[model samples]
Target: MPPNLALEIKCRESERQALLSFKQSLVYRYDILSSWTTQAKANDDCCNWIGVGCSNNITGGDYHITRLDLHNTGLMGEIGSSLTQLSHLTYLDLSSNEFDQIFLEDVASLINLNYLNLSYNMLRGPIPQSLGQLSNLEYLNLQFNFLEGEVSEVHFSKLKNLKALDLSDNFLRNCTLGPYFPRWLRTQNFSVLDIAGNMISDKIPRWFWNNLSPNLLFLDVSYNFIKGKIPNLSLKFKTMPVIILGVNEFEGTIPPFLFGAQNLDLSGNKFSDISSLCEVNYSSPLYLLDICGNQIFGHLPRCWNRMLNLASLSLAYNYFSGKIPHSLSNLTRLKSLNLRKNHFSGEFPSWFNFTDLIVLDVVDNNFSGNLPSWIGLRLPNLVRLLLKSNNFHGNLPLSLCNLRRIEVLDISQNYNISGTIPTCIYKFDALTKTLNASEVPDYLKDLVMMWKGKETLIHGRNLQLQRSIDLSCNRLTGEIPNKITELVGLVVLNLSRNELTGQIPYNIGQLQSLDFLDPSRNNLCGENQDRLIVQDLLFAISSGFIIGFWGIFGSLLLFKRWRLAYFKFLRNIIEKPL
Candidate 1:
């Protein structure tokens, strides 16, 4: 932006007043609007204001504020009508705010707008038909909103100059834009297009595959009912694009040409064999490939050694059988691997070459034999280790204590594992810490899990359980480990159905992060059960408080009896004897 020296003489008074009216219709969490004042003392300059950019007009009109970017600012409320008054605006972004829907209905009046983003807001209702009037728009993003209903050609009638369009995470479903694929999409060339999670159900037309933009670098149409096989478009994309078509009804084998992309997710489809994995030439640049929850089966592919850049691979929830091939161990940079819910059997190969693993999930399979003792040493950075419902047997490995960064460890329901719980369990350092939902690590969001007794596949983000250990449903004998209470970050602790005898740890209440706990069906019985239950109930309440004082524990808030009883429990723990 060029320097704005003369603010008063250059800025048009009417446009500056329009900006003030724009600020009037909203709520502000900070005094960020102080510079937008109309007071004479502050110079009443709109062009020099924060987030406001002005440019000299070719016709020599007053310097007009051509840009207004207030993304992620703490502004909330409905879109003001005064925005349309700034007719010279060519760039505007009001994303990631607690904002409105009416803006779309009037934003089209700014015909000069070449870039616009209102994503991650509280906008609702049908997308306004007037948006089609932005003929010069090159970028438009309305992702993460509540807009819905059929999207017709009227929505994009004059948007021929559009280069990037993202309408992800809404309830929209239609075509003309959803009984069929958008017929008009083939006309406009897009560098980035994301229409994921809209209920558009139709086969991707062949013309779309033929006329795919050569400049396309990102295309996501996942989480819908769209079908038809994805064709190989390696030659179409001049630069490798990140393509995601997951959770759709697409059928047929994945094309080997897709391996040419930088990142690809064809998971949750009917794609048959990954024989294409072997067809790709060595030195493949693919870094992430998730084909999980498909019907692809047969022995594990042995060509993983070819893709040296492959770091994250997820093939869970498929019919894959046979031992994991040794070639998979060749990728030294492998970080995350998910192979759960398959027929993979045999003791986990003790010779893994990839030490960069942060997430190693192989749950609910038929793999047998003892848990590998070398895992803790081989993958020191392992954060999540899930191996539940497998046929693995034998005592818990003491070497697991060396995993200081382990946050999630589920070695449950493998009945044959026996012996006392390790006393060095406190050595798993990450469990001893605490974190709220918003503070959760980015990579952990890749998981889909539910809390409480039922473990279902739901996108984890809200009230989802994290951290903790699950060593339940085993033949392990001996007393409950008292040192386990040191793990203040443990969220779900299920030690039920084990032969463990003795009293519950008195300091178990120290686990303030416990969301779900089950010591029932074990030999942990005594008059202390009431005391322990009450103590854990308080922990559950605190856990609920950590993730916003609502959800999952609402019964205590809504019912008077439960509310009084909770207060009584609190009074008892304070005044009465145990």
Candidate 2:
């Protein structure tokens, strides 16, 4: 067709009316589809409207709408059936909406759809099997939705051109995907497959791997109950894949076939050994390796120097013991290291000088001795330092105050740790100012923290502006440092269950952002005692009251300072001004 002739073509009036009817059914946050109006002459052309794509299939025939992209437009309500009238549509995107599930059946009538995305919506109930009628659909995304019921092979019986499928974060069942090996997928070659966070609870059949698409570049089956060990076979890949099989029940030695992946996560499984890590031939440069919460035990492999490209590594919640291999220092690009809740013993690695390091979590380990004083000097970029529940015994190193960007500092529950709270603690500027969301690293985005004796997972957006310090359940004995109150952005400050004495900081009230402050069980008392919540007050005095209230009060009366404070409190209660 001539260029001038194409410009002269106008969309069929029927399709324009259909789109206008569709808009009547929508409840949008803003008038994003304001161009869909039909009052003006140019606006009457549906093909010229925003997000609508049109093309002339005939030399002189009328143009037809072939695409409708409305994802993330904040449109919600009952999706109108008028969309079924646009039979020429080869591409359609209606994701991230809150529309009702009344149009899926109507959508099946359009056999020309080659790309369909209805993810992150309120579409509920079983997917209509008639959807398979669209044999040209090459990509389908139904993730993060409320769709339910068992999906059989018939649901995709005619989708022979399908190349990518995502049904993650749904309420689908194990049987929804069918037998040990979905033989229905033997013919199609997919590049990306994600079925995570579902009810998948069967061992991956060996035959399934043989049929796996060689073109696959991304696979995520995490957060399921898949069982059995991966057969020891040297599988190959055409691309550097990013595979995630975390939070499953796969046990035994780490398989070598997985080494070909550039980013791999096998955490929260029953795997007992990882010697294969050192034994395998390097197939690709690994960037991220997370095997946390597994049964892998004994000394870490000393061959970490082989993967110098490693940036993020996590072996937390495992049984691994013995000193961390010194070869870890060879990974100069390391940015995050999480060895939390393990039996790994020895002093914290003082030699690691990775300037790009952002997060270091070694909580609940047997690591003992004074924390290496060179931490701040070695890793100046440290943002979250969680060293709680260890045998670390010594004064809180003042050098730690040099971590200027630190947001969360939890050196709590180390029984033998004793010292006056460092006055230089306020140097952590991240704790005093509202940190921009961009300043938080990707590794600390899902960082966890203990708040008020309960474990809480604080996400990055909230954590960026929230600062915390937990030094509870330790033997620290001294007056709480007055400089601590300078951190105006501090949200959670816990110093409970310690033997600290003297008054609380006089400027404690200055922490305007303080939400959960616990100073219970400490001998410290002051006019700012009202800062502690009622629950903490009960926790502080209930134990002594149960043990022997009179005895405890009698002992306090023997001290002149305690006696005067007690009488003053009693007099204030009795001499009511009213």
Clashing pairs in 2: none
Give the Cα-based TM-score of candidate 2 against the true structure. 0.82
RMSD of each: 8.8, 12.6
What TM-score, computed on C-alpha atoms, does each candidate reach? 0.81, 0.82
Instruction: Mark the regions of model 2 whose C-alpha exceeds 4 Å error after superposition.
Output: 1-6, 13-30, 37-45, 58-63, 171-175, 178-181, 232-239, 283-285, 434-438, 454-466, 475-478, 496-503, 509-525, 528-578
Q: What C-alpha lDDT does candidate 2 achieve relative to the native structure?
A: 0.76
Model 1, 338-448: lDDT tens digits are: 998999989888677467888888888899988787878888888788888899888888888888888778888898899888889989787776763323345334454
Q: Looking at candidate 2, what is the lDDT of residue 242?
A: 90
lDDT of 2 at 199: 43
Task: Return the TM-score for candidate 1, rounded to 2 decimals.
Answer: 0.81
